[model samples]
Target: MSLLEQLNQDMKQAMKNKEKDKLAVIRMVKAALQNEAIKSSHAELSNEEELTVLSRELKQRKDSLLEFKNADRLDLVEKTQAEIDILVDYMPEQLSEEEVSEIVKQTILDVNATSKADMGKVMGALMPKVKGKADGSLVNKLVLQQLS
Candidate 1:
């Protein structure tokens, strides 16, 4: 099933099971997906698009968690982190740093990226292949390290 369909099914199950935390997170995800669909003229989102949405949501949660901790709001931090956990359930398995480095190394060579000036070329070649499976910042860092 598509990610959105799976989310809808899970949302119903969450409601039936009285899983408030799971239900709330699922609802938030559905809303974001729906918003994206509407914005994109009702086209169904590709898996890549779905991953993009989830990544954005996860990042927001992580940012909020940090802010909450800084403000000594453990309650909010816990809540936001729970939401992040739920969102992460649907993401592709993250690649290890070593695996990412291997791919980055190959990409750099593939694109003939010899210097900092070729960063864009390397990143453009790498991001699509690693999308959803690796963190963008991490991949960028590896690519830079290899180039340097």
Candidate 2:
């Protein structure tokens, strides 16, 4: 099923199960996706567009999780973590660190990226292949490691 369809089904299930946290997160993400669709010229988002929205949402939660932890806000941290967990359920299967590294290495080669200066070239050619499959920070780290 498409992500939107799956989200709709899960939202119904969450409501039936009385899973408040899950339902809230699903609704929030659904709204975000819909807003992105409206922002663009099209009314329906393509798979890539949906993935982009998903990635942005996940990244926002991860950033908040870090900030919450750093501030020693245990309660907020827990809530944010639960939200993250819920969002993750809708994400694509993640690529492993080794797998991402290998792809980064190949991307470097494909772009002829020999040094840090060529990082942009490497990443430009790489993000499309790895988007929604791996963490951005992990990919950036691997690309830097490979180039320098």
Candidate 3:
């Protein structure tokens, strides 16, 4: 089944099981996907567009988790993290650090990125390949580390 189809199935199961946290996260994802379809005036979103929206939602949760942690609110941190976990079930499995490093190295070569000045070139070429599998800030840091 497509990711969206799987998400829909899971949403129904969550409701049947009375899984409040899981249901909440699933509802948020459903709303986001619906919003995207409406915004683009498309009858259905492409797989790439679905992945993009999923990644953005996951990223937002990660940011909130970090903020909650920094504020020493363990309760919110745990809650936000649970939501992140639920969202991740719909994402492609993440690439390992070694795989990410290897790709970043090749991207730098392909883009002829010599310094931080060429960071944009490297990132532009890399993000498409890395999207939904790698953290953007981590990728940016690795690119800068390589360029420097």
Candidate 4:
């Protein structure tokens, strides 16, 4: 099933199961998907577009989780982590750091990226290949390490 359909089904299940946390996260994802569709004037989003929205939501949760941890807000940290876990179930399987490093190495070779100056060129080519599979900051760090 398409992501949206799966989400709808899961939302219904969550409601029936009385899974308050899961239901809330699923609703937030749906709202984000709807907002994205409205912004682009599309009747429906492609799976790739939907994945992008999911990734963004997951990233937001991770950032919030970090902040909550720093502030010692254990309750919020636990809640944010639960949301992250829920969102992760819908994302593509993440790439390992080793796999990402290999791709970045190959990309640098493909682009003949000799120095940090070509970072942009390397990143432009790499992001599409790794989108939804790897986190951007991790990829960026790998690229910088490979280039330098």
Provide the overall lDDT of each model, using Cα atoms, as 2-decimal numbers: 0.90, 0.93, 0.91, 0.96
Which candidate number has the best lDDT? 4
lDDT of 4 by residue, 1-148 (tens): 9899999999999999999999999999999999999999999999889999999999999999999999999999999999999999999999999999999999999999999999999999999999999999999999989888
| Better-scoring candidate (lDDT), 1 or 3 | 3
Model 4 misplacement above 4 A: none
* Least well predicted 10-residue stretch by lDDT in candidate 2: 105-114
Clashing pairs in 2: none
**Structural similarity to truth (TM-score) of each candidate:** 0.94, 0.98, 0.95, 0.98
Q: Could you tell me the TM-score of candidate 3?
A: 0.95
Order of quality (lDDT) = 4, 2, 3, 1
Steric clashes per prediction: 0, 0, 0, 0
The list of candidate 2 runs beyond 4 A from truth reads none
Across residues 24-79, which tens digit of lDDT does each residue of candidate 2 receive? Answer: 99999999999998899797999999999999999999999999999999999999
Please say which candidate is ahead in TM-score: 3 or 4: 4
